[model samples]
Target: MSVEAELIAPAELGTSVVSDKGESIAPQAKEAASGLLDQGDAMTSLAQQAPSVVERMQDFLLVGGPVVWILLGFSIIALSIVLVKLWQFALLRPESNRDVTQALALWRAGEHGQATVVLKRNRPVSELVYIAMRGVLNVRQDMDLLKDELERVAALRLNQLRALLRPLEVIATLSPLLGLLGTVLGMITAFQRMEAAGNQVDPSVLSGGIWQALLTTAVGLAVAIPVVVIHSWLERKVERVAAVMSDSVTQVFTGQQISVVAEPELEELKRAA
Candidate 1:
C-alpha cells in the first residue's frame, strides 16, 4: 500500500504541473488572437471608408458648381506652368555664379583664352559673360555698341525667365475673385430657394446653403495662396539672376577699362628705360 501511494503521488504531482502550464498559456493565446482580430477589423474599416471618403469629395466639388470647376482648371494650369518653369531653371541654372566669378578673374588677369573657356558652362550668366569677353577681345567693338548688344541679350534672357509668370500672376489674382463670384452666386441661389420656400423655410436649409456658399471661397483661397507664394519666389529667383548677370558684365567692362588705361603708361615707361 505504501509503494502504490508513492507512485500515485508522483503521477498526481506531474498532472498538476501540466495543468498550471496550460492555464498560463491559455490567456497568452487568447490575447494574441484578440490582437490579430483587432488589427483585421481596423484594416477592414479603413477599406470600407475609402470609397465613402472619395464619394464625399466628389459631392463637395459637384455642389460648388461651375466656378469650382473653373478653379480646378486654373489649378491644373498653374501646376503645369510651375513644373515647366522649375524644369527650365534646373536646366539653365540661372543662379550659378561661381564659374562667372572665376571667368571674370581670368579676364582681369589677361588670360582671355582661359577666361572664355571657363565661361563655357551651360549657365545664363556664363553665356552673357562669354559674349561680353568675346566682344571686347575679338570684335574690339565700341563700348556703347557692346553695351547696347548686351542690353538686348539681357532683355532676351530675362524674358525667357519671365515666361509663363504672367499667367501665374493672373491665376493668383483671378482665383480669389472667382471664388467670391462663386460665393455670391451660391448665396443668391440659397436665398432664392429660401424665398421660394416662404413660410415653410427651415433653418437647416439656410445654414447648409451658407456653408456650401462659403466652400468656394475656401477652395479659391487654398488655390490662390500657394500660387501667390510660388509666383513671388520664382520672380525673386529671376531678379537674382538678372542682378548677377549685370554685376558680372559690369566687372568685365570695368576690368577692360583699367587695362586700357594702364597699357599707355606701361609703354611710356618702357620708352623711358
Candidate 2:
C-alpha cells in the first residue's frame, strides 16, 4: 500500500510542471507577435505619409511660380494698351465718300456758306476740309500757296493722331533692356548666396533667382511684340488717311471752276505765323 501511494504522487507532480511551462511560454509568444504587428503598421504609415509630403511641396511650387506672375503682369499692361489704341483708330475714319459728292453739290449751287457748314459739322475729317475751304475763300489764291497750306494742315492733324503713341515706342524699346537689367541683378544675387552657402549649397537653392531671370526676359518680349504689331498697323492707317486727304486736295485744286489767283496779303499772313 505504501509503494502505490508514492508512485501516484510523483505522476501528479510531473503533470503540474508541464502545465506551468505551457502557460508561461504562450503569453510571451503572443506579446512578441503583437509587437511585430505594431511595428509593421507604423512602417506602412510612414511610407504613405512620405508621398503626400512630396506632393504638397510640388503643388506649392507650381502655383506660386515666379514666371507665371511676371507673364500675367506683362499681358495685362500690353493688352490694355492695344485695346485702347484699337478703339482710338476705330474712331479716326476719314470723311465718308458722301462728303465728296455733297461738297461738289454745294459748290455747284453757288452757296459757299452752306459748303463750309457741311465741312465743319464733320468731326474727324473737318480739319482737312476746313484748310482747303480757306484756300477757296481767298479772292487771290496762288496754287503753290494753297498746295503748301493743305500739306501743312494734313501734317498737323497726323501729328495730333500720333500724340500718345510715343509711350508705346518707349515701352517697346526699353522693356528688353529692363529685363536684361533684372537678369543681371538676379544672377549677382544668386552668386552671392552661393558664395555664402559654400559647400552646403544645393543647386535648387538658386531656383528662385533663375526663375526671376527667365521671367523678366519673357515679360520683356511680351510687351515688345504687341507694341511692334500695333505700331505698324497704326502707321498704315495714318498713311491711308494721308493719301485720301492728298487726293481730295488735288481734286479741289485741279477743278477748273475754282480759279487760283495770287494775293500778297495771304503770303504775308503765312510768313508771319
Candidate 3:
C-alpha cells in the first residue's frame, strides 16, 4: 500500500509539469527568467532617462554655442597666421652664411666682380647680400650714405614682414573686448529673467545665466593668450631679421673700407674753380 501511494504521487507531479521537455521547470531557469525581467525593467528606466540627458545637452549648447563658434573663428585665423609665419621664416633663413662671409672678404680684397658673382651664386642669403651690394654700388666710397640706404632697405623689409601680423594683433586686442561684451549681454539676460521670475526665481536659472556669462570671458582668454604668445614670437623673429640686416650692411660697409666724406671741402674746391 505504501509503494502504491508513492507511485500515485509521482504520477500527480508529472501531470503538474508544464515544461516543453515534459518535466518540472528547473530552479536555475526560474532565476534566469527573473534576471531577464529585471534587466528589461532597467532598460526601460534608462530609456526614460535619455530625454533628460538630451535636454541637458541642448541647454548647454543654447547657452555656450555662440562662444564656441567665436573661439573657433579666432583659432582658425590664428592658426593660419602661425602657419604662414612659419613658412616665411623658414624660407628666409640665411642659406649660406659662409658664402656671405667669403663674398665680404672678396669685396674687401677689391674683387667687386667676384663678390657679385658669389652673391649671385648663392640662394636666399644672396638676396640680403645683393641689397648690401646695391648700396655699395650706389654709395660707392661713402660709408654713411651706404649705411643709410641699407637701413632704408631694412625698414622696407620690416614693414613687409609686419603687414599680415597686424591683423593678429588687432584680433588679439579685440577678442577680450568682444568676450566682455558677451558677458555684459549675458548679464542683462540673466537680470531680465530674474525680473520676469519675480519672487519665484529658480536657482538653476540663475546658475545657467552665470555660466553663460563666464563662457565669454573664457573664450576671450582662449583667443587672447595664444595670439599674444604668437605675436611675441613673431616680434622676436622680426628683431632677428633686423639684426641680420644690420650685420649684412655692416659687413659690406666695412669690406669697402668706406668712410663718410665731408662735402664742405668739395664745395669750396668747386667754388674756387
Q: RMSD of each candidate? A: 3.3, 20.2, 12.7
Q: Highest lDDT: give the candidate number.
A: 1
Query: Which window of 10 residues has the lowest lDDT sum in candidate 1?
Result: 118-127
TM-score order of candidates, best first? 1, 3, 2
Against the reference, the lDDT scores of all candidates come to 0.92, 0.68, 0.75
Q: In candidate 3, what are the lDDT values of residues 1-273, reduced to their tens digit?
A: 699999999888776665534444577678899999999999999998999899975675577658656766887898898899888777656333667778878877778878878764323445667767765677455857656765676677777677679888987888888788888888888989999999999988888898898887887888898999899889877777677666876777666654233356677899999
lDDT per residue as tens, model 2, 176-240:
76667666766777788889999999788698768756666766676678777887777677777
Which pairs of residues collide in candidate 3? none
Candidate 3 residue 196 Cα shift, in angstroms, is 1.0
TM-score of each: 0.87, 0.55, 0.62
**lDDT, residue 23, candidate 2:** 94
Off by over 4 Å in 1: 1-18, 139-145, 262-273
lDDT of 1 at 213: 92
Q: Model 2 RMSD to the real structure?
A: 20.2
What ordering of candidates by lDDT runs from best to worst? Answer: 1, 3, 2
